[model samples]
Target: MKEEKKPYFPMFVDLSEKNVVVVGAGTIAKRRIRSLIEFTNHLSVIAPEVNNELLELETAGKIEIRRKNYDREDLYDADLVIAATNDHQLNNDIYSFCKCMGILVNVCSDKNKCDFYFPGLARHENVVVGVTASGSDHKKARAVVEKIRTIL
Candidate 1:
């Protein structure tokens, strides 16, 4: 018997009122945070220490930064969670927790553990495009996103 892998559907969501939480503050997490902030106002970041840019965003009231280790309590209000920690175990734990809570989760290090994959985005006035290579080729997805951006 063989397993089947279904393609991820292209579903555009409204994040304006959703509570999005990113569980790491490193470069990968930062990029996700940056993209999310453009669409949602209720974004929370949890980590022991974050970079200056995140600190500035916190100071400016764009996102909430919790300067501490991750706990399940931190996700109490999250509608969507991005597990972007460098610690694989931690990311897995977060994924399990999110699953139990029925929360949508993206684990940056493991596609199999993710409930959703972040897409390369292109946004123009009154239009938004999302592109992905199904977690196989990010560079290709980005190139396509760039082309889409130019078209927009």
Candidate 2:
């Protein structure tokens, strides 16, 4: 039997001026939002209820917040979308919607639904190392990250 290898494409993206949208305002959503802020200055968060952390970010003028549930129109102006809602169906919906629009999306509920997986990342100064097992074994990925951490 012929073995097939999955394609891996790596690219560096400059999110400095991109318009990124995050759906949901829970803890997971907050984490995703915070990470995005590190790379981009333009961030839009959509959720009916905002958590204290996100509210704080809004108060600091770190990101734009929309107090409303997600709608298809929300993805129109987004350069990237992060579906971090606790509702799995909603996340799936957002993922599908992004696909139809040819937009890059990350679904927190399922890695398979995401166009790109968020790997375990270690940062020191300006150096960042990301580790991933392509969703096959996250534990192994974490182990790899630990090894990388020791070297960095």
lDDT of 2 at 54: 83
Instruction: Give per-residue lDDT, candidate 1, residue 109.
Output: 91
lDDT value, residue 63 of candidate 2: 92
Candidate 2 Cα deviation (angstroms), residue 25: 1.7
lDDT of 2 by residue, 1-152 (tens): 99886845555688889889999888788878877777888899999989788889889988999999899998898989999998999998999889989999999888778788677877777787777776678899899889888888
Identify the leading candidate in terms of lDDT.
Answer: 1
lDDT (0 to 1) per candidate: 0.92, 0.86
Model 1 lDDT-worst window of ten: 3-12
Against the true structure, candidate 2 has what lDDT?
0.86
Task: Please list the Cα RMSD from the true structure of every candidate, rounded to 1 decimal place.
Answer: 1.4, 2.2
TM-score of each: 0.93, 0.85
List runs of model 1 lying over 4 Å from the truth: 1-4
RMSD over all Cα atoms, model 1: 1.4
Q: In angstroms, what RMSD does candidate 2 have relative to the true structure?
A: 2.2
